[model samples]
Target: MVLQRLLLALINRAQLVERLAESKAIRRAAQLTAFAVIKGRLAGKQASARLRDSDTARMMREEARRMPQSAADAAQTVSRIRNTFMKEVKEGMREANRQIKDRK
Candidate 1:
C-alpha cells in the first residue's frame, strides 16, 4: 500500500512536469531544435554515404572469392559490398548520434 501510494505520487509529479513543458515557449523551442537536428541528420547521412570506404577489405575478399569473376558476378558482389558497407556506416552514425545526444 505504501509503495503504491509513492508510485502514484511520482507519476503525478511526472505528469505535472510534462504539462508544464507543454507551454507555448517550450513547444516552440522543442520544435526548432527538432527541425535543426533532423536537417543536420539528413545532411550527415548523405555526406557519410558519399565518404564511405569503397575499399573495404571484406569487399576485396568477396571479390577475390568470386571464381569465374564474370561481369554480372562482379556487379552482384559490388552491390552486396555496398549494402554491407552502408549498413555498417549507418550503425556507426547512429551510435555517434546517441553518444552526442547523451553527452548533451
Candidate 2:
C-alpha cells in the first residue's frame, strides 16, 4: 500500500515535471526513483540473508518464497517493476500534456 502511494506521488510529480522540464530531466528523475526502490529491496534481501536466525529473518525467508526462483526470473521481475513505473510516468505526462493542449 505504501509503495502504491509512493508510485502515485511519483506519477503526479513526473506529470508536473514534464510540463516544466526537459525530457532528459524527467527520465533522470524516474530512473533515480526506480533505482532507489531496487536498491532498497536488494539491501533488505542482503540484511535478511545475514540474519538467518532471527524472527525477522524467518519472515523475510517466507517473503522470499514469493520472489523469483532463478537469476533470469529475478532480472525479469526487476525489469517489470522498472517498466511499470516508467509506464505510469509516461501515462501521467501524456495526460498532463493533453490537458494543457485542451486548454489552448
Candidate 3:
C-alpha cells in the first residue's frame, strides 16, 4: 500500500511537471538556439525512414565494413557522406517550410 501510494505521487508529480513545461512562457523560454524548426518530424516513424532510406546511413554501413584503400578514397568517402546528409537535411528543411506555409 505504501509503495503504491508513493508511485501514485510520483506519477502525479510527473504529470504536473509536464504541464508546467508545456506552458507558453516556459516553451518560449526553452526555444532551441539553433534551427529547431528545420529539424522537422525526426522522431519515431520519421527516424525509421531516415535509418532505412537515407543514403548516408547506407553508405556509412558500407564504408564501415571496408577499409579505405588510400587517402583519396577516405576523402571521397567523407565527401559523399557529407553530401548525402546535407541533401537529406535540405529536403527535411524544405518540407518543414512547406508545412509552415500550409499552416499559415
Candidate 4:
C-alpha cells in the first residue's frame, strides 16, 4: 500500500539523513509524505463515521471539533492542519537528523 511505502521511505531516509543529510528535495518529499499520512488519518476517521453504527453520530461530532468553521471551510481546515503537522514534524526531524549527522 501507499502508506506502507511512505513509512518505508521515512525509515529509509532517516538513515540516509543520518549519514549524509540528503538534499532539500528529500526533506520536501518527506514533508509531503507526512502530510499524506495525516490526510489519510483524517479521511479514515471520516470514512469510519460514514459507516453508521451506534456511535457514528458521536464520532462525527467529535471530529467536527477539530474541523474549521463553516461547511465551506472543511477541506481547507484539513489541508491546513495536515500541512502544519507536516511542517512541524519535518523541522523537528531535520534538527534531529542534523544532530545525528553531527554525531557521526
- Per-model TM-score, in order, reads 0.41, 0.35, 0.56, 0.33
lDDT (Cα, 0-100) at 34 in candidate 2: 100
Per-residue lDDT of candidate 4, residues 1-104 (tens digit): 99999878877876665754467777788899999999999989976764443243444455677756787778765565567556656775897899899999
After superposition, which runs of candidate 4 have C-alpha atoms over 4 Å from their true positions?
1-69
List the candidate 1 regions with Cα displacement exceeding 4 Å: 1-56, 65-68
Local accuracy by lDDT, each model = 0.79, 0.72, 0.85, 0.70
State residue 100's C-alpha deviation in candidate 2, in Å. 1.3
Badly placed stretches (over 4 Å) of model 3 are 1-43
lDDT at position 63, candidate 1? 72
Tens-place lDDT digits, model 2, residues 4-101: 99878877886665775667777798899999999999989976674564444454465467777899977876676566556656775897899899
Our model 1 lands, by Cα RMSD against the true structure, at 10.4
The 10 consecutive residues of candidate 2 with the worst lDDT sum are 51-60
**In terms of lDDT, which candidate is strongest?**
3
lDDT of 1: 0.79
lDDT of 3: 0.85
| Inter-residue clash pairs, candidate 3 | none
TM-score of 1: 0.41
Q: Any residue pairs clashing in model 1, and if so which?
A: none
Looking at model 1, how many pairs of residues clash?
A: 0
